[model samples]
Target chain A: MACFLVPTTEAIVTTIATKIIEKKEKEAVSTELEQGVELSSLHRERFSVKLNRLNHLLWGGSLLLAFEHFWHGEIQPFFPFLTAAGNPADWAEALHEMSTVGVGMAVLVTCVWGVHTWVLDRIAQREGMAQHEEQARRAIRK
Target chain B: MTLLITILAAVVTSCIWYSSARARRLKTGVLCSMFWGASLMWLVDAVAEYIELGAAYFTPAAQDMLNDAFLGFSVIVLALTVWVVLLFVKDPDGVVRSALHNQRS
Candidate 1:
């Protein structure tokens, strides 16, 4: 299956940025910003470890399913020869077809994962910065 | 071919897991996990098929445990991903209001 997170993540970030962070950055919602997160106070290292483990397990898990599909006579059996583009009439033909598109699909998946991770990193940084600023402002107010 | 497939699956899974775990801790939700997990799954199977081109390389020791593990992981993670995403989309303001909002209340 296609990785759904690239678009989903982008959509989420875009919405949050446009409606929430952007307004704060522009000083358009100063009141809400003051009431929202005191960003820097977050302890994120613990969270990071949890996310990393989850990613590895899930990615591996996905591959395992695909393996099962072929091993158990799902896609691989039908394709037969492993060729690309058109469907094969037998297992031999399906095997041949697998060479071209399979690799490409793998690369596509890795790339999507990379991009999604990149966005997550950015989100973490943004949250950290916001928290820091909030803490500083509170300190000054005191 | 099976040996290579096993190796491919192990390496890719480890990398994805490590990277994604880091992302999850820092970011807000489970989007990265689902995307990364699904992508990695496809990659492992795709590579195995590609390498199986040489019948001589196929081995006898494929791990059946992998299937069970993956199935369990996918179901749990996807469910969590869906729940988290819906929560974020439906009430964008709630998360930022308080850390307690994030708790399983």
Candidate 2:
């Protein structure tokens, strides 16, 4: 009840304040920039999309596992909305124990994935440098 | 469950088969065939679990056979990937030289 009341009060105040604060849109924005310049001509951040995907997948999987198996009972009564598997009271200890295992596993997997990425990046970079050198050699030969 | 499993297995096999078949002219077709054939055998085992058999001759045979087949093919694929990565690393300079020459020509 306190959580609900506090947030509601805050929201109402914030909404009224927002209405009092006048907001205006700019009519015209003029900016000039040179065209025909390659974006990659600047130093680009080389990011591995695979690693980002893997991080998202790991986070989402852990969140689902924690919610379904760990926080099943307690967080439900306050909201009175979430469906739980059963009384987590009996299994709360078990859930607490499993958290150690889950976090340990997540850390271990993250390390392994990091190692694999490091290997891949190092190999890719070495190969790329080798290619650049080869091209330079050919240019000199020409 | 049986039907769904069979369909999923079929899709996987089809993909492996397609990739294997589309390998360059120099590449052998044995790998693709072996992989898909073994997967089919496993699918048959899964199907057998749902099936009611009066005769006991081939009842337990499917799983045992498929298990051995999966083990064999997986080892072969593992060795193949190792060999390919090794090959790529081995003649790195020569490959790069040829690549640059081809690009220039």
Candidate 3:
């Protein structure tokens, strides 16, 4: 329910994706009569490159964050599984907390992702149809 | 700390996944995976800490909790910073590049 914390990232990513999809769809329809599959491949490749770049950034930043946390003494070398607790009750409580929070967050993220996919697909479909109509009109005028 | 961190990570991860799924671009997937990975890491940490602290884990001192919150916030900020940098580097829509070229012309 508290998903509005990062509106900037959402807005930037959305705008960029919309622009790329529109451009690629227009190009595919106008230039290639029967190479629809190739256009799909190209679209996939665009995403791959973007994802790869993000992955590099993610890894680099994560390592730095980890080191910082280590310095702060929040993270121990033994970490999640191997750290020693004082008793069974404390261990159980921690496990309970982790499962409840971790799993809850996972579910929430999945739901948001699902909604985003649905909405974007609808928008893309509508835009594609509009483009098709414009192309048909040009052909008739010629 | 673990709880807060996981929730925030999940939120960012979902946003990234949605962007990737809809645009069919890998643009945000890296961010998504990173957050999810971090969440997993914290999950392990929580489990380990619980095992160590047993019942006392439920009643952590105020200072420790505060520290965890700060660390969690820092992680989220760092992730966002990285994402922003990648956006500039890739300039997926070439908006940055075009703006520069236009200014030069």
Candidate 4:
């Protein structure tokens, strides 16, 4: 019932990390610009972009799942928030579900995101290669 | 039932995202991931329940099925609401910004 909490926790951590990293990235960019160093893309996406994608996936999924849990009356607006908190037996079951279903979901989402980032990187690398080839061919013709 | 519904939503959103580059501006990928993640979570839940209940898992009560269907539909609505809010805030087309400017002028 409280399975969404796992991803919600992950999202919170990632959100904080994104904010910190984003600040650092902006500072780095400014320093590079001040040094008159030309920043090249190399067709590679920024780490922040990839992190944001993971953040989006985690946050959006957690939010929707939380809403669904609320709809099912598993969650309450009151203290404890979870219906399973009322009793020890139910609490134990909830914990079991959290460990199994919740953890599984969190891990699954992370794995999917990892694969997605890998694919994007591969695509970007291929694009960079093609651009390099095109430039080389143009230079030869010139 | 919720699993089925979410899987369908994920497939539909993914198809839209893949077919239309314009949809990327709307950030349909967020919706796609949300639905797909939910579907996967539900699938795991279903499997766990099957293990616990064995053959009885296949014969869920009618009321439970209805409840799941409602929950699935509600989840879809909530996801759409979130996506819409994001779109409005981002205003990728500058629609809101231009509207405000027009009004001021």
Which one wins on DockQ? Answer: 4
Deviation in Å, model 4, residue A46 alpha carbon: 1.0
lDDT of all predictions: 0.47, 0.40, 0.56, 0.86
Candidate 2 local lDDT, A17-109, one digit each (tens)? 434432211111111123344443332223434344234324322322223222224335444342332545635644543354433444443
Interface RMSD of each: 5.7, 16.1, 6.8, 1.5
Model 2 off-target regions past 4 Å?
A1-45, A56-91, B1-105
TM-score of each candidate structure, all chains considered together: 0.32, 0.34, 0.46, 0.90
State the displacement of the C-alpha of residue A89, model 2, in Å, after optimal TM-score superposition. 4.6
- Among all windows of 10 consecutive residues in model 3 chain A, the one with the lowest summed lDDT is A1-10
Q: Per-residue lDDT tens digits of candidate 4, residues B17-90?
A: 99998998778988887887777667777888899999999889999999989988988998899889988899
Per-residue CA lDDT of model 3 for A1-142, tens digit only, reads 1111122233346457656776776676566656445554344334334333433333433453354446454346663522324456755654564465434433443344556556766787787789779999999999
lDDT of 3 by residue, B4-58 (tens): 6756776757765775664335356656655664564445446656887899988
Across B1-105, the per-residue lDDT of candidate 2 in tens digits comes to 222333344355446556663442322223232233223333333344446464552455676556545544444444346435544555434775688789999
| Better candidate number, 1 or 3, judged by lDDT | 3
**Lowest summed lDDT window (length 10), candidate 4 chain B:** B36-45
- TM-score, candidate 4, is 0.90
RMSD vs true structure, all candidates:
17.7, 19.5, 11.4, 2.1
- The best candidate by TM-score is 4
TM-score of chain B of each: 0.31, 0.34, 0.80, 0.94
